[model samples]
Target: MKITIAEYLLKRLKEVNVEHMFGVPGDYNLGFLDYV
Candidate 1:
């Protein structure tokens, strides 16, 4: 099985009880920002 970097980061954030991820929605990170 393989997990993507986005998946890993989301999991870690959840583990730390992170509730919000704030950032600008731009072309470069718009995709990744969706996971936030």
Candidate 2:
């Protein structure tokens, strides 16, 4: 089976048990942080 990048990343995060992701508000990281 093939998985998209987003799906793959979310699965990896779940596998690692990453409940919370922290980051400050900034231009570059804002989108990534928001997605988390």
Candidate 3:
């Protein structure tokens, strides 16, 4: 299974009890934002 860098970071953030994440989405990050 392959995952994006955003997914790996989101997973890590989730582990730390993070329910919300904020960022300035760019063209490259838009794909990752879809999952969030």
Candidate 4:
């Protein structure tokens, strides 16, 4: 049942019907992008 913050966030975004997002790709953003 362990989930990362990034995983949780992406899941919520999908629930709200978010199909795309824009952001700079960098070291800090890599973790979140892994979910996408």
Candidate 5:
């Protein structure tokens, strides 16, 4: 099975038990933030 970048990150977060993430919105981070 193939996993997308977003899926991979979410899976990793779950493994680490990350419930929330914080960050300010920026041009570069917008795309990544949107995925989260």
Candidate 6:
């Protein structure tokens, strides 16, 4: 199985029990946001 960097980050957030997140979506982050 292949996991993207964004997916890995989301997994780590889940491990720490991060239920909510705040951010400003920009062109650079649009791809990363797809994992959310």
Give candidate 1's whole-model lDDT: 0.84
Instruction: Put down candidate 2 lDDT per residue, 1-36, tens digits, no spaces.
Output: 996665677789999999986657888765555446
The lDDT, on a scale of 0 to 1, for candidate 6 is 0.95
The root-mean-square deviation over C-alpha atoms between each candidate and the true structure, in angstroms, is 1.2, 3.0, 1.7, 0.8, 1.8, 0.9
The lDDT of each candidate is 0.84, 0.71, 0.86, 0.90, 0.84, 0.95
Question: Residue 33 in candidate 6 has what lDDT?
Answer: 84
Please write out the lDDT profile of model 4 over residues 1-36, one tens digit for every residue. 999999899889999999889999999988788788
Ranking by lDDT: 6, 4, 3, 5, 1, 2
lDDT, candidate 2, residue 34? 45
Estimate the overall C-alpha local distance difference test score of candidate 3: 0.86
Give model 6's TM-score versus the native structure.
0.85
Per-candidate TM vs. native?
0.76, 0.50, 0.59, 0.82, 0.60, 0.85
The predicted structure with the larger TM-score, 1 or 3, is 1
Candidate 5's residue-wise lDDT over 1-36, tens digit each? Answer: 997787789789999999998889998777777678
Q: Give the TM-score (vs. native) of candidate 3.
A: 0.59
Best by TM-score: 6
The weakest ten consecutive residues by lDDT in model 5 span: 27-36
Shift in Å, residue 2, candidate 4: 1.1
Ordered from best to worst TM-score, the candidate numbers read: 6, 4, 1, 5, 3, 2
lDDT of 2 at 26: 88
Cα misplacement distance, residue 18 of candidate 1 (Å): 0.3
Better of 3 and 6 by TM-score: 6
Instruction: Return the top candidate by lDDT.
Output: 6
Q: Which ten residues in a row have the lowest lDDT in candidate 2?
A: 27-36
